[model samples]
Target: MGHPMIQLDNLDLKLSLGRLVLNVLYIKSGFFYHSMPEHRHSNGSYELHYIPSGHGRLIATGREFPLSPGSLYMTGPGIDHEQITDPSDPMFEYCIFFEALPSGRNHHERLYGRSGGDSEDIREIARLFLETPFWIGQDSRQLQHVFEKLAWEINTRSIGYRRNITIQLEQIVIGLVRNYTNNQPTLQTAPLKTLDDKRMVLIENNILYNYKHITIRTLADQLGLSVRQTERAVHKQYGMSLREKLLEARLQEAARLLDTTLLTIGEISEQVGYQSSESFTSHFKKWQGLTPSAYRTRTIVPTIQ
Candidate 1:
C-alpha cells in the first residue's frame, strides 16, 4: 500500500503556525563500528534514524528493531535507545534531530515570550512523535533529500540564506502518523495547480520583470496569504523562507551591478531598495561576510590582475 499524506488539520497545525519557532535542527549520516552510545536526548527533542545499508538492531525500552536497508526508527526525547551494529556490516544511519519552541507540554510561559516563550495551548502535540513507535522497512528518498540539503546548509557558509528544515521534518512525522493510522488522504476532486506552484510562477514572472524591490509583504498580498503563510509557502516550494529568497535576489542584483557598473555604494543601495548605504552594507555583510566595497575590491582585483 502507498503511504498516506499528512492530515494537517488533525494535528492542529493551522492554529500554531504563527507562534511556532524552530529551536534546533541537525542532520548527520555515518557508519558505526561496534554499537551506538547508550544515551537519551533532552526531553524536548524528536529524532529519526534511517538506515541506508548494512545491518544492526535498534534497542529501546526492551524492544529490538532489526535494522536493514531502508529501515527507519524514531525516538522521543529522554527515551533511551541503543544500536548494536554488525561488526562485519556496520550500520550506516542517517539521523535527524530537532525541537520546536513552545511545543512542550505545560510549558511555563510569560507574555510575549518574555519568560517561557511563545504561547502554548498544547504542549504535547510536538511530543507525540517521540512517543510513537519506530517505523521499519520504509524506503523514503524524499526524507533522504531533506536530510541531504539540511546537512549541506549546516556545514556550508550559506548562513544568510536561511532554510527551514523543520517544516519538512514535521511533514515526515505526519506521514509516519498517517502510516500508523493507515489513513490515506482522499484524492482531490480534480487535478489543479498547487498553491505553491502558482505562487512560484507568479513570483518568477515578477522577478523577471522587476527584482529591484520585492518584499515579503508584496508576495504575501499577491497570494492573499498572511506574511507567515506566504513564508511557509515559499519554504514548502523552495526550501527557503521568503526573506531569504528576496535577499538572495537582491544580493544577485547587487553582485551584477558591482561587477558591471561603477555605481557608488549609496547609489547601489538605493537601486536595491535600501534606504541607506549603512543598511545595505549590514545586510550585504550578513550574506557575503564582506562590505559592498570589499566585495567589489575582491571581484575587481581579479580582473585587474
Candidate 2:
C-alpha cells in the first residue's frame, strides 16, 4: 500500500458548541490515492478515521493494518501514524478530532484528557482501541450515513447547518467511543447505588416541571429530605450547589433561546425565571462575559448578514 494523489477539498469548519473540533475531507472521485504519511498532533486531540469507499493500509507504532471500505481507525493524541490507500480504488474518509475533558477541568482542557472515563477504565479502553489494528470487514453503513450528513452540511453551508453539523459530529464521536468502550472488559464494573443518585433524578424532574417557582424549601419537602440534605446531595452529584445548578440550567436555556429565536432579551430573561432584567443581565454577563443585548447582537446579527 502506498499514498496516492487525490484532490482534497476543504469544507467549512466551525466550533459550534463545545470545545470539540471537526474537519471533513472529500477526496474527489477518480483520484487514485494511497497513503497518509505518519504524523502527530500536538494538541492532544484524538483522531477518528472512517473510510467509506476504498481500500488502504495503516502503519502505526511499527505495525501495519489493512484498510478497506467501512474501515474505522482511532489514534490518540501524540501518536505518530500513517495510512496507505490502494491506488486502484479511490476512497472517502471523514476525520474527527476531539478532546475528552476531565470531570472538573475547564471546557477546553476537558476535551484533551487522556480518557473519557475513570482513570482505570480509560486505560483499558485506550489500550483496546489502540491495540486493535483495524476494524475492517465490518458493516459501516451507520458510519457512512453520519459522514454523508456531515458532508452535506459542510458543502451546502445551509442556514443553521454549522450548529447542526457540530452537534451531529459530537454525537457520532461519542457514540463511536462509547461503542468501543462498551466492548472492552473494564466497563463491567459493578454499579454503585447511591441515595443522591435517586434523589438527583427526582430533583431534576421537579426542576424541569417547575423551574420558575422552584425554591430550596419546596424541593426539600418534595424530596422528603431536609433542605441541608438535599443541598448536599446535589452538590455531591454535580460539584455545584443546588442554586448554582439551577441558575446554570436557566442560563443554558436562555443562551439557546438567544441563539435560535427572535425573543427579546427582556422576554427571554423572564422565560428563564429572572424577575428583573437587571438581575438577568448581571448574571448573564458574569457567565458569558456579555450582557443579554450584547450577546444577542454578537451571535444573531451575523446570521442576518
- Tell me the whole-model lDDT of each prediction, alpha carbons only: 0.55, 0.56
Q: Would you estimate the TM-scores of all the predictions? A: 0.41, 0.42
lDDT of 2 at 4: 22
Candidate with best lDDT? 2
lDDT of 2: 0.56
Q: Give the per-residue lDDT of model 2 (tens digit) for 227-303.
A: 99888866654456768867776776687678557999899999989999899999999999998778877933221
lDDT at residue 70 of model 1 (Cα atoms): 70
lDDT of 2 at 62: 49
